[model samples]
Target: MALKPSQPLRLFAEHLREQRINLTERWMKAVFNDADLTESDRLTYEQLADHVPAILEELCSALEDQDLDQVEPSIERNAKLHGRLRWKQGYRIDELVRELDLLRQVLLGAIFGYAEQYPAFTRRHEERARYFIDEAISFVTLTSIREVMTERDRKIDEYTGRLERANHELLLKQKLVGELYESRMQLTRSVVHDLRNFLNVFSMALQMIARAPARTDTALALANRQVGDMKTLVDELVEYSIVLGDTNAFATEAIDLRALFDELVAACVPTVEAKGLRLVQRFDRELGTVVSNRLKLKQIALNLLSNAAKYTKVGEVEFDMHVCGESQWCLRVSDTGVGIGAADQERVFKEFERANHEDVPGVGLGLAIVRELCRTLHGDLRFASHEGEGTTFEIIFPLRLDTDG
Candidate 1:
């Protein structure tokens, strides 16, 4: 069997030592001295270096073992230990230990092979034997270096991939944090405002009763109106909290764009007549359908229409509906009202963000709810306005295909 070819044994042992030295140098001189190293990273590297001596002893013992069968088993056991040190007992230590392990295996294998082959020569030929061992060790060392470098590069690439994924997860977490904070702030404002309104109504009623022990019908009726305002304020606060709370609870369904505007106009007709304002619904019936939460969609439309009525003294609020493309439908509500300033247009969609309007009565949660509702439905809400001219708000949704439920 040609003595089972001693080349593999020599090659494995040479790489084992080269890898060990290279790793120890990187850790002791490079990684340990770097100021940027985290405390945790430094400690892991320290632990790895402390455990390397025992592993090197095993490599040396396997070289002298006379039984070739036992040599293979010893190499296998040590190789596994080396892999764990390089990859598992933590990253900082594993990095160096892995290299060391590779060098040990390479050098030990070369040493054992030369010993086995030279025992047959009777004459003293130390120089010739040294030359053979040196050539074999050099070739094996170069090959081991190339293999270690390839593995090192792979580890670096893996580290980079993990970093990018962690960064992306952090960004998502930040966005969720902002949403949760906003919800908490809204809850606080709701409680405070409701308490103030309740106190004001109770005080007014008590004063009216005190002045007239046997209350006149007209005085009682006037007190009752103040009580009604308190109720309306309470209802608005509750509704705002409910809509903003989970934003994702609404059930989605297919809706017709033109028909949705028509229903919205009908519901607001009574409010429009009382305010002496005209609402015109101009839409293309062919605009067709979209998939969304119907009740939530209606709420968004009613909020916009009510806002328009609140701001307009006598001008008209028109709904212009059309299909912009094959996969989208555009629904715009344009009003010739007090209008909005350029800066205020963006702020209007933020919670508690009210514009400067002395005539309009609001705590400023309507449009904020509208924007939130739009996002939940996978649509977009945007506005363009010129102060004192008019404001136009556009909403777009994905078209309902024939395959939609």
Candidate 2:
């Protein structure tokens, strides 16, 4: 059975059909002028008006028949297509709903204008027209929001998967590099250990030859000194290898600052005096106990003091210990020695790097080890120097070591 058209609805439908083009134009103008609908600015006139004309045709048919079900398929198809296009054009869900609402307002105004022209158009016809427009706009808004959210979720998942794969590949490469480095360090330690053993045997032989009743004392003394220098180099290499391999090698304990300084100065006295240089020591009266890695602290102090004694000729090597702040302390080793030049100072903390003085008895691992150990103990090493004016190396350490490091 065919449903008969209602006279008022048929008249309203006819009016909407005649004003369709003008209504669409008005809707476009409203969208462009709306601050919230800025996404439409990049779209062309046809692109922005896509499927709207079809929607208006279906709306007119549904109004005239007074049966929305007959025109539902066409209406739904056009509305969904418009939604997807808006999503691709970067329209937010709110903007999409707002534009549709604006269209509804424009059509309602046309409806009122038609009602005023025909005396038979009553409140019942206006209400029916409003209900159909509201239902259509509601369906379009929900459909568009669903499509936009679906696309958004899919893109998020894709980007997250890519990031995970990249991080996994990075971890694998890092593990491989670490394994190679460890293998090289192990081989170096083995070779250096063997060389130290040979040097020790050679030193023993030179000592025995010197004791012989031969006039080779000067030559034997020089040979022994050369062996000693080689032994020192090997020892530094071993120390550097150990520090590199095990970051947590040192344990913290309460150490007496005055006692530690006294021990270090006593050890360096003979070397400084041999060069006709004085060893000066000064301790602040408030020197107290500190909780730190004792062995590492001793190592840093000894390296600085030894470097000072090795380079100075006649001036004093001063070892000063003072309270830097309430929670920290400072050790300053200043020397009147052949100081490092500006060019060499930058590489002073780099492995196997030496200063301009090639005659110095070192393989240049001293300062590098000192710096690594300083950082491991939550401390810092800094220096100031000028060529021929000598250098001052200062290290500041926290009173208490942080175990987390």
Candidate 3:
């Protein structure tokens, strides 16, 4: 009842596969704690592991008998016999091979003894064992091929996932491009309309001057003033477009807040006086120079001040330059003016959107431009207002004090 030494090498390997499967499954479960492994996968490995003993026994017997007949029952021989094994199967190799070598020697000794004791009966059993061993060797070869196929399939899956993600991003980019193109067309139409109106007015002013030569002086001056206003509007529109398009629009520069505020107040003092509004200025000496885009920051401040002046009929317009939160410079502008409504506050920053007001005059781009400029400088703008009481706009910017000489 012993295996023989004359068994095929195929049987020796099958015996190893059986022992390896069991040891691997046990070790892997202990180490991994069974993370994400499906029941089917587990069952497959378990079945393979359980069959390890039979596989190894056959291998040993085949090797001893030198017939290779027992090799047919190996894991590789029958394609439909088992499901896919988990990656953990590789762990069982050492132990299985060790046990298999021992079995081979034992069976080999049995074979020599059987041949010596009963040469007549040995031939028939040897032939059967040889057939089994041959099948088992084929099965073992198939298992290795299966492992290779599994690896290839895994790589393919990874590639497919990456391709899907890339396609999603590409679609988003295409949508954005379409939206931008439409916005550009709208902007172009607006520019052309404004230009046509400006030219028409210029033509009418020229005709009026030609008709009355004596009154031409006054008419020309008024016409020139209108043209100047038109030019200012055109400049603002162009600047806004450039700022929005360029990612690197804000060039950092060191500026003194006190000096900047003084200059802004001086520039707007004539308008403030014309409106009969009191201007109050307060500067904190401790607030030092901050590094930012000086022009953009000035544009924001000027817009807020102009908005305040436009809305206010009589009260005081207050400007305060001070340190707000920790290491942040803040410019607060308060005006006792006809303030913004709660319903319209959120939409004020959108392009070409103005609150419903009878007295105010603008294309509704001032606040939008202000917000964009603030964003470019890595700052934020916020406001609080009441319809009849007053309005306050706050600009908060991180203080990056220049240290390099």
lDDT winner between candidates 2 and 3: 2
lDDT over C-alpha atoms for residue 342 of model 3: 93
TM-score of 1: 0.63
lDDT of the structure predicted as candidate 1: 0.62
Write candidate 2's Cα lDDT for 1-405 as tens digits: 432337788878887888888889999999999998889999999998998888998889988887788988787778778888888888888898899989988988887888898767778878888888877777766776777787778778988999899999999989988976875675467557646765776666677676864736765776677677777777998898887778545677999988888888888888888899988889998979999988888888888898888877779899999999899999899999989999999988877667978677787788988988888888878899998989999988888887776
Q: On a 0 to 1 TM-score scale, where does candidate 2 land against the true structure?
A: 0.57
> All models: lDDT?
0.62, 0.83, 0.66
Worst 10-residue lDDT window for candidate 2 reads 1-10
Task: Report clash pairs, candidate 2.
Answer: none
Native-referenced Cα lDDT, model 2: 0.83
For candidate 1, the 10 contiguous residues with the lowest summed lDDT are 120-129
- Per-residue accuracy of model 1 over 131-247 as CA lDDT, tens digit each: 433433333334334445556678789999999999899999999899878867875786577567657766766776888777656556766765675666666667777886873
Best by TM-score: 1
Q: Which candidate comes out best when scored by lDDT? A: 2
- For model 3, the run of ten residues with the poorest summed lDDT: 79-88
